[model samples]
Target: MLLKNERISEIVDGKRVIVKKPELLAPAGNLEKLKIAVHYGADAVFIGGQEYSLRANADNFTIEEIREGVEFANQYGAKVYVTANIYAHNENIPGLDDYLRALEDAGVHGIIVADPLIIETARRVAPKLEVHLSTQQSLANWKAVQFWKEEGLERVVLAREVSAEEIRQIKEKVDIEIEAFIHGAMCSAYSGRCVLSNHMTARDSNRGGCCQSCRWDYDLYQLSDDGREIPLFSENDAPFAMSAKDLNLIRAIPAMIELGVDSLKIEGRMKSIHYVATVVSVYRKVIDAYCADPDHFTIREEWVRELDKCANRETASSFFEGFPDYTNHMYGTHSRKTTHEFAGLVLDYDRETGIATIQQRNHFKPGDEVEFFGPEIENFTQVIEKIWDEDGNELDAARHPLQIVKVPVKRPLFPYNMMRKEN
Candidate 1:
């Protein structure tokens, strides 16, 4: 079965035009995150499998789980793609053909790859599965895109360093689908090709062993005339850091749509479920609002605020306008904290008693004020007037993680609804 039609009508230049809305693609690190991504409004989700995936540390999917995830996503009219984007050595090539065939049998919509061997092997052995070139290839020009299109690849995830004008030029010249990162973390290196982790920690970043050595704190030193090293700064100065700010293109949706970008991808496969849900939901609203009525669309402050609650680092519109400057890079050891924390997820609700069953994620006590939100409901805040456990015993707090609790609520809530509290 095909996914839902994403094309919508918009009035452009006094003409009614039908535009293909960009797919809101989200990251699914595991099965739970996959469900959350679809529930919160992702048009599609990309996940890492157990082998040949870039995120070696993530709890990736098994072939069976990939099948189950495909079944779940199809019910919601969404698509699932598997990531086999790791740069391959000879040792990684033996069983890849079988794995590709297995993914094709598991009903995966496509496979994202960066290596020539895997691409050729997929085309030869697993021709049913669509192949998308990963951003690790760093295709920044129209000629590179044309080369890939000639090779029969369906899509090319443009390098993050590609500017808006470059994207426009590529669309003008190339006929392949274009995918770009719309939100999430940024690599300090070009298109995530970095050797800092391999040099510092003996982990090959291109082969799924990145240790994020660039984000670590490092002390700056100066060599003295006596051939001794001296600290560059006093005790009060923070250690130097080279982490790039996270990407936030909440305001760039309209322009990307006009450029005919096929997909807007969120970049964290190992992120938390709350982060996946919040980011996907925010972008979903933005894309829909802009596509529904381009002439009257405006960026909403609440959308930005909702995104701010889930961010762990400061965000920037990196490389979208042009080359980034000093403001795009984080130079000191500073961490960002959000104002809200995920507290619980709704499991079930009883309309007669006006009570909702919740699975506690963080801590929440009776009388605490919290906001509840869902895919189909407007956010509403209400005090936790009463709490009970699964056994119907009253409780003072839902302090334990994943604890099943019942709470009285003023409004009806559905499954997958999330609740958050002030930090």
Candidate 2:
């Protein structure tokens, strides 16, 4: 059996060739999520610092936290990249040079940059730090990729609008490393260049304060000849829509691997730790399985099921197959529901006593059946027959968030193993 980090040999044309698997890149909104990403088999994790990040609302990392996260990921052979992808204004320019230097000193692998100002400053101030062009640049053509390559960018995150054929063409023409968004939310505008947030909520979508105005509902109205207002439709009709369905590309893993894309990125920096773990683990398995043997590769139903468990919105393979149609765009009310809910996280496990210590994430009572999963172990379902608090007192339910609890287990679990229950 082929394992991760091992290259596979394939016969292309009439010659045998060696193929290195693409890196699995995930997102981290905080230190805990960063650890969860690496623990679940991410090859690299991208995080946003406190400044110059589009995810301004996220609990971004401090320099010290970045250093700690780097150390944690390094132990698992994973890399850390910091995001400075916001389009900078005049006031955002000051102290950016210092921040770039600090990220380099903290041993970050690279910085995902969008603004010309930040890119130039990183090149000038921190020459050793690798610079990656963010997807915000919207480099959809091969010539744009060539331009960045000549300008000294190590990689380009292609715009989400780029189709599968476009990606293949870009790879054929440009020799620079290619990174593509494999799964996550899709931007309603062209590569997230929307002004709706700025016009409606006074929040700049480019410079980090996006209010997601595109996802909001607005009353549809029409004007009469007398200049009076009129309702466009009855209350039963769906609202005027602009939101796009979330991207799920599990079915396209084999094609992406064959296209020679260097990295497959998951786009959710502001998502929960449960989200990070679930999504990363699912992709990790899919990529490894396909790379193990290309000829016999088949998309597993369990992989799709695992992804569906964490999805908060409707999902579709957008833009990858071809130009998206009406099915790609979401209208009316979106059901932000999933098949499962994260119940707890494993803190410690005892083999002799068949007991496991867990930190509660959601409410669970005795007799509730929960499923435990991790990167190294097969998933198993167990019924909660008894629960004990940290003080060894019996508890009726694991209700309090982050509360420590003990439960009996049939299989051994390690730290970072997550448990979820059917919703």
The number of residue pairs in model 1 that clash at the backbone is 0
**Against the unseen true structure, what C-alpha lDDT does each candidate score?**
0.90, 0.90
Model 1 ranges with Cα > 4 A deviation: 1-18, 219-239
Clashing pairs in 1: none
Instruction: List model 2 lDDT by residue over 66-150, tens digit each.
Output: 9999999999999999989998999998999899999999999999999989999999999888999999888889999999999
After the best TM-score superposition of candidate 2, give how far the Cα of residue 360 lies from its true spot, in angstroms.
0.7
Error of 2 at 280 (Å): 0.5
Query: What are the TM-scores, per candidate, against the unseen true structure?
Result: 0.94, 0.94
Q: What are the RMSD figures for all models against the true structure?
A: 3.4, 3.6
In angstroms, how far off is 339's CA in candidate 2?
1.2
Please, what are the lDDT tens digits per residue for candidate 1 over residues 1-423? 011223445567786553778889999999999999999999999999999889999999999999999999999999999999988999998999899999999999999999988999999999999999999898889999999999999999999999889998888787889999999998877755688888989998998899888788889999999999999988998777777899999999888987788999999998988889899999999998888778778999999999998888888999999888878878774567777899999999999999999999999998899998888889899999898999999999998999999999999899998999888
